[model samples]
Target: MSEWQQRSLASLGNYENGFAFNELHWSEHGLPIIRIAQITGSQGIVDCFPGVLPESYRIDEGDLIFSWSGTLAVVRWSGGPAWLNQHLFKVVPAAGIDRSFLFHVLQASVAEMGKRTHGSTMKHIKRGELREFSVEIPGNECEQRKIAQVLDTLDTAIRETEALIDKLKAVKQGLLHNLLTRGIDPNGQLRPPQSETPQLYKESPLGWIPREWSYGSLGTWLMGKPKNGYSPQEAGEWTGVQMLGLGCLTKEGFFGAQLKLAPAGDRGLEKALLNDGDLLISRANTRDLVGVVGVYRDIGTPCTYPDLMMRLMPSEETSAEFLQLVLQSSKVRRQIQGSASGTSESMVKISSAIVTGLKVAIPKPDEQSVILCRSKALDAQLQSELQELEVLRAIKAGLMDDLLTGRVRVTPLLKSLQQTAAQTGA
Candidate 1:
């Protein structure tokens, strides 16, 4: 702590805001105009700028960029040379400052910057406000590098885990599509696609499916009517009854993190109470998300679904897990989205008729079990990696708080490493 000193962002670096590139300046082929949306990953850089601009506006790989409006985030640019758009600042670290350390510190300061933002629609901090934001840093550049090295290691692991998770998800998606169409053979292997082995498949309303599969409307496999859930006024206090939000049912499946407390005394509450393994579908949402399905797993609390969702129970002939996975298939998803109707494009509704009438290829119970077992195996791997990611993030957050604040000194750690290296060389 003795070597650490508080420093303002302006003192450690020059913050250069990018030029405002409007639609008129957008071109199809040229250097990308990096926007805040592109930094946040909500949008890609489709439009580029052909005209050369000032050197200050040109950002290359390994530069530090801070998006100051809407979303406050600090990113290390990894893409090729491009033009920087408005509301973003290109940070040039001072001679004594470690660029990597400065990048991590800025990321840690985003929440503080967010608190000082103005404007109702799009929040932004003035340059003066940003300049005053301070953080504690060690005066020694060597100590700074040590701290940055520790964080960078964790970041590398996090990035690799994220990449692996994405690849696994893509593989799982392809496998799922195959299982739903080509299906598992009697020997417990994926049947070859119709393109490779035409004799194994037959034509159906849904498309070419394995000969062992039967095609029919979803209603034929349902135990009873698809009941709509209940919605009551949101309770300010915990009333012991939790209601699932529209976000709870995602394409990946049920996520209870977005739950809201509901009044237990609501008249129709009993009807909406969910049982473990109960399959749910969004009755109303955006066209892309309207018919998203998930199964309610016990969260160790009494929870109910809202009116925007519908509950279904599969007949003895159907496996609930298989049905939930099937609903996520591109074919079934298209049917659900295609049948959806609403006055606003942002919000749409899918009725029971549409859900029941959607065509599907049903596999035998044993085959369904085999398919689910394999899918769950992949899902388990994804979830494990996801959990590892969460832990790594939490660890990074803690390390940044300690290492950056000088609470957990890296000077001693650095010396220990240096001694170990010398001994090894000897």
Candidate 2:
């Protein structure tokens, strides 16, 4: 670590708490108001809130904003002047200290400051405590500038990579919507009418589908029944059987590598044991995240689903991959939302009765194979892009931790300090 001078946060800047504006005062024409939710670390501002205030309450550019309650983060201003909400605090750096350097110091102190929080109902970092916090400061402005430049470069890279990942995800979603809704052969050349049921191509429970495709429930093709796993009292050894929880399911699919293991006796696993090709669907969660579906493709290890999940086993006629894709479609998701039962907070619960009653159009066996192959190919391409983005993110995170903490010094950029000292004969 570099030897540095220590100073309290109050000495380097003036901390100003935000003021609350009533909902009636909010207007689109006024200055943008910054909320605690808008502070997203070094990643800069986000469009989380849309409240406005007059120029009197506006905070200038380059001011560091800290979220005092709920979610905490330190954001550096990139846009024009903006106002701060009551839940946020604006720190304006004084003449001697660099604003960007102060932002990094605040970012580095997040963990320690979080520990100082006190309250049972909601966490908070008081203004007094925040102002009293101490941080190391380099004596030379040249050194501060060099350090800030290096850290800012890494932050820029992280933001760029995140933007790229978002674009790729949007592209994948658009492709899925097109391929699933309008079949690949869109020229009307491949689709042919069936002799048995010519008018069957009309509307049904799930919108328009081909006449040859048949509708059936999930339970009709299942060999074993869907069941929930037993709840354990404590965490213990694996005993060769792993217990899958909601955390093991990612937005894309099953995350088998991060599965938590539990003893066989702990899970009370008998008929609820999971097998390869079995489908797992989240039964209860937030409205948008309730019906996530994942197919278990791993074998050689036994696993069981927790109470919040439902398992599906297809019969000889149905393809597990096809069902998995169908369940993930927006049509099924909308139906699941409609069928959900609750008072204020609704949850999608796919019971044995509901699963059996649900209908799906199944393509011919050969056609199903082709669709599965095409879907898998698309998924593989997306996975590769996601992996590359993850690596870039990790690299940026590592660089931030090192450079901002002063563990890594920029010696090459210190030449300016040497020249200044030589001229001053110090």
Considering every candidate listed, which one attains the maximal lDDT? 1
Which residue pairs show backbone clashes in model 1? none
Task: Assess each prediction's global lDDT (C-alpha) against the native.
Answer: 0.90, 0.68
> For candidate 2, lDDT tens digit of each residue in 1-426?
446677776687777778776666566655665776555533444322355444435677777887778766788877677777787778877787788887877887777888888787778888777667887667676777778876776677667767776786787676655445443333422343334444536555666666555566656666677655554543566578777777666567777766666655542666567878778877776667676778886656877777778777777876677778777777777766666655546554556566556566666666666666667877787677678777876765675566555566656535665688699996
Error of model 1, residue 299, in angstroms: 1.5
lDDT of 1 by residue, 1-426 (tens): 787899998888888999998989999989999998888888987789999888989999999999988878899999889999999999999989999999999989988888878999998877887668889999999889889998998899999999999999999999999888888898878887799999998999988988888889999999887999988899999888798889999999999889999885787889898999999999999887899999999888899999999898899998778899889999999999999999997999999989999998999999999999999999999999999999999999998999999988887766786899899999
Q: Candidate 1's error at 341, in angstroms?
A: 0.5
Clashing pairs in 2: none
Off by over 4 Å in 1: 414-426
Task: Give the 10-residue window scoring lowest on summed lDDT in candidate 1.
Answer: 409-418
Per-candidate TM-scores read 0.95, 0.81
How big is the RMSD of model 2? 6.8
